[model samples]
Target: MVEAARILFGEHGFHGTGMAQIADASGIRVGQIYRDFESKEDIIAAMVAADLSDFLDEAVLAQAIAMGDRQRVRRWVLDLMIRKQQPNDSTLLPEILAEASRNPRVAAIMREGDQRIRRHVAAALAMLAPHAESACARCVEELMMTLMMGGCSRRMALVEGDWQFLEGCMARFLDQQIAWLADHDDGAAAADHADA
Candidate 1:
């Protein structure tokens, strides 16, 4: 039922999908579904939890970042994202995001996921830049998450052979960015610039 809900919600926006549609697709009775989940929101919540359990391994990500092999680690992460988007993730995510803007339940879920990633990124930054202030580390974490998330929607869609070009770019950019962060005391300059 959850899988059906994911597909239906992706195909038809959250508002467009009906509980009957999910029941029909999953071949589950509406009564049974209702017994399991109180509402459509609950089903979607379960779907998100299932996705997170299978999709992200924060420990592996942290280890990869700690190793400082930007090329390899970034590619590893990219490969995972691309693989996750295999059939229809790219489309599904955008649909959810659009719906989340209007739905408080969805919004809360998305925010929680975002904060989880932010915490992961902050941990990675702390591994790299030991001298970093918590505030500065947080700022870099947010920036990395923003840029990465913005690029992900399309990058996953184009999983061309080997992704060699993309790999090099990701490595070079990450290397430079990490070095810049290392040199800065607390991202104070970047923060200052953003204020203007």
Candidate 2:
């Protein structure tokens, strides 16, 4: 039932899919779905959680944590964003975002996911950026997320691998973030940035 909802939601979106259709796709009775999930929203919420955990797991997050160099952190941020910005991911996320906008329940789930990622990013910054707490840290985090969310939507529908441009943009954004951080305190920034 959960798998059915993911595919249906991923394909037709939350608004377009019906419980009956999901049951049919999953080869389960509609009533059986209710036994597991209270409503479509519940199912979608689970899917969102699963997706978030699946995408940003401990292994990947650990690498981000182990990194401490400013230039390296910037490159790592871009590389991570590029990897997560697969075409289908951006396409599916907007539908979820739009659904979230109309439904408070959905919005809550989305916001939770966003908060989790933000905290993860912030922690990574703190480790590699002991001296960066002001605008520079926030800007780095925001730019990385923005590049991921925006680039996914913009480049998802393209053919022939257009994400290379997004990779370049991410690299540039990282460079800017590094320079901005360096200006605050180069020695401390460099020391934290060089974490192996």
Q: Which stretches of candidate 1 lie over 4 Å from their true place?
A: 62-86, 155-163, 185-196
The sequence of per-residue lDDT tens digits that candidate 1 reaches over residues 1-196 is: 8888888887887878888899999999999999999987787778777776566676677667768755545554444433334365766788778868899998998888777666666665665665666666667666677666756666546644555665566567656656766777556655867999
- What TM-score, computed on C-alpha atoms, does each candidate reach? 0.76, 0.78
Top TM-score model: 2
Tell me how far the alpha carbon of residue 53 in candidate 1 is from the true structure, in angstroms, after superposition: 2.7
Clashes of each: 0, 3
Candidate 1 lDDT (Cα, 0 to 1) = 0.69
In lDDT terms, how accurate is model 2? 0.72
Alpha-carbon deviation at 55 in model 2, angstroms: 1.9
Ten contiguous residues minimizing lDDT sum, candidate 2: 67-76
